[model samples]
Target: MLDIKFIRENVDLVKRVVKNKQLDISIVDSVLKIDEKKRKLIGEVEELRGLKNKYASEKNIEKGKETKLKLQELEPRLSEVEKEFLAAIYKIPNIVSSDTPIGKDESENKVIRSWGTPKEFKFTPKDHLELGTKLGIIDTELAGRVVGTRFTYLFGDAVLLQNSLYQFALEVLLKKGFIPVLPPLFINPDVYTKMARLSPETEIERYAIERDNQYLIGSAEHTLGPMHMGETLNEKALPLRYFAFTPAFRREAGSYGKDTKGILRQHQFDKLEMESFSTPEQGLVEQDFFVSIQEELMQALEIPYQVVAICTGDMGGPDFRQMDIESWMPGQGKYRETHTSDYMTDYQSRRLNTRVKTKNGVEFVHMNDATAFAMGRTIIAILENYQNEDGSINVPSVLQKWMGKSKIQTK
Candidate 1:
């Protein structure tokens, strides 16, 4: 949610942003009109309230009965009007950064830079699904028998590979002086709403216990960002860095055709999430640190990749600005989003009430999050980049110790 004052002062600018992003623009107009109605209603109601107070002190109490009765008739209507105004104000989005490029979708996204080339394959390379099935390491069919589509069971080497990725990612983040935390897989709807991650459209991708009013977390970020919700951290504790590991659930609604063949678009997957809380001056610096860690993690895995700044349309409503690190997938012959390092500034903090008390008595902390490693995508990068002519997969050196094996070959 944006500050109501900001929206009041900049309705036209807000209209331009959501319009360029292809969102419904009428929402902006609705907000402005409702706010106007609310202001007038408040003044009227306050006058009535003041009159009621005045009657309480009247020289002749019975003489004030007519005015009191009129106020009683207006009170309920005033209450309803105030409720409508607040609802409309909450619909407005945050102010977008001017540097964000205007575009309709990801295709219009600009590639800021690029890295290592896709390796030459002596033999046509197989995708992760083909390799997994051939090695009897991934069992999607049995997974279907047990839990239905969009779920899978990993065995032997595939299990090792996935576990290796998690262990390696956790170690890397820990070495960076980040505190590791494992949060509850199930979270209340209220907390989800506070995190600004709850959406009706995402229900299909999410596993929700509607009766319990709880949602399975879709990303460790959902927990990491709100960990300090409604709390005030000391300014001296400027940047509280945290690394989180958790299994994410999503219903993958409306994404029927893309990434359907493998774990790339699963209903459940694992990830290592990095988040931080900092002062306004410190948000970008924390973002830079997160980017450095992301680059290092990719380098450790020996994956070729590039970093690109997200356009205004691509930055979600809660993010002020974002940058993504796309790891090179040789088989796909393109870079895909592997990690996104973002600076949300006070976008999320305003809602979560996670603030810092500066020595100067200032408040409202800045919050930021980045994907340290989204397991399924990392595995895709691994298989595509390190496949052998004989159908073996080479474990990246950094993960070899954790994997306890150098290469994953069919038995």
Candidate 2:
């Protein structure tokens, strides 16, 4: 949610964001009208309270009773208007950063840089599903029967490989001064809404535990971001960095018939996510560092990848600026998204009420969250990129120590 003052002063700019990001233009008008009503009601209520206090001080019982009656009538109206104002304001999306490319959808996204080269294979490469099935490590057919489509079971070396990826990413993040965390998998809808992860457009993609009124998180960042909600921190702790590994759930509601053959798009997947709170001056730089770290991880795995600048339409509503890393998938003969970095500035912090006390004054902290590894997708990249002519998968050298072997093959 944006500050109402900012919206009022920059109505045209906000409307431009709505148009560029493909949101309803009328939302701005609706919010401003409701804001005006709410402010008027607040002024009335305050004036009545002052009158009531003055009567009490003067011992004017008859006048005090009349003032109290007016106060009762106006207070409830003010409360109702406040709620209406909040609902309307929440619909306004964050302002887009000047550097973000204005475009429509993913196809318009620009590829800024690329690393490594796609390896030439002696034999025809197989997709991760085929390779994992042949190696007897993935059992999606049974998973489908037991739990429905878009679920899978990992056995033997596949499980080991997943753990190795988790540990490898954790070590790298730890070296970068990030504290490790294990966050709750479930979040209350109210907090989730404040984080801007829950909205009508995204409701279909989320899993709601209606009985408990909690929603299953789609990313660790969802839980990690609100750790300091409604709190103030010292400026010296300006950039508090944390990372978490969690099993994320998604409905894949609108993604019918897409990546349906493999774990590439699953209802349940594991991920390592990095989140940080920084002073406004350091926000964009923090995002740059995150993307650099993502590139470092991919390069260490010796996988080919490209860095993409996510266009306006393709970026998240809360993201002021965004970038993604797409890894080469040889079997698919193209690059697929494996990681993303979002610099939200103060958009999320403003809603979460996570503030920082600066030397000059208090202000909302800028927030950044990025994918350290989307385990399933990264695993797919590794399998497709490192497959052997004889159906073996060579473990990335960095993960080999934890995997305890250089290659994964049928026993």
Candidate 3:
């Protein structure tokens, strides 16, 4: 959410951003109108409060009663106006950075650079889904019977491979001074709403356990973000970095028939995610650092990949800037997105009330969240890229130690 004052002062600029982000500009206008009414009501209420104070001080019962009555009526009106103002403003998106590219969708995203070369296979390479099935490692049919579609049951070596991916990512993040956390997988709707833009418009994208009145986390960031909710931190704790490995759930709502064959788009998957709270000036640097870390991890795994800058319409609502890491899938014969990093400069903190108190003053802390490894996608990348002609999957050199074997072959 943007500051209403900033929106009011820069209406034209805000309107331009709204259009660029493909949001409704009328939301800005609505907020301004509500803000104006709210301010007017506040002034009237303050005057009435002053008069009531004066009447009481002078022992004038009649005027004091009348003033109190006026305040009672005006205060409720002020509350309603304030609610309207907040509702309108919350719909507005964060101001995009000037350097952010302008594009309509992911198709228009700019590729910054690529690393490694896609492997050339003398024999046809099998997709991960086929390889997993042949090796008895992944079963979607069983998952469908057990749960529903868009789910997978990782068997034998596949489970070990995912664990290896998690440990490998943990080693990299730990070296960078990130604290490891196992956040709650279930978050109350209120906290989730404040940490994320979970309006009725996009609520279908989330999974809610109606019986428990809680929502399962779509990503570890959703849980990590609210750790400091409504709390103030010391300046020395700036740039607090955290990483979590958790099972993330999503409804995959409205995404039918897309990547439906494999673990690429699943109802439940494990992910190692990184979240950071930094001083305003350090937010972008922290995000860049995360991107570098992601690149390093991918390079270590020896996967061919590219980094792409997300455009306005494709970026998330709270993102000031976003970047995605796409890994080469040999079976697909293309690069598919495996990771994304978002720099939400104080956009989430403002609503979470996660702040830092310095000698200068207090202000909302900037936040960045990025994927270290979406384990299922990482598994796909590894399986497809490292497959041998005989249908065995070679483990990345870095993960071989934990995986206990160089290659996984059918039993």
- Whole-model lDDT values for every prediction: 0.80, 0.93, 0.91
Question: Which portions of model 3 show Cα errors greater than 4 Å?
Answer: none
Q: Candidate 1's C-alpha lDDT?
A: 0.80
Q: State the lDDT of candidate 1 residue by residue for 268-353, as single tens digits.
A: 88888888999988987888899888888888887889888787666776677788999877666777898988788887788788
After superposing candidate 2 on the true structure, give the runs of residues whose Cα lies further than 4 Å from its correct spot.
none
Misplaced by over 4 Å in model 1 are: 51-79, 200-205
RMSD of 1: 2.4
- Cα RMSD of all models vs. native, in order, equals 2.4, 1.0, 1.0
Residue range with the least summed lDDT across 10 consecutive positions in model 3: 193-202
lDDT score, candidate 2: 0.93
Q: Residue-pair clashes per candidate, as listed?
A: 5, 0, 0
Better of 1 and 2 by TM-score: 2
Q: Mind giving the per-residue lDDT tens digits that candidate 3 earns over 144-239?
A: 999989999999999999888888888888888999999999989888878865777778988889999998899999999999999999889888
Q: Write the per-residue lDDT of candidate 2 for residues 145-199, one digit (tens) a residue.
A: 9999999999999999999999899889989899999999999999999999998
> How close to the true structure is residue 132 of candidate 2, measured as C-alpha lDDT?
93
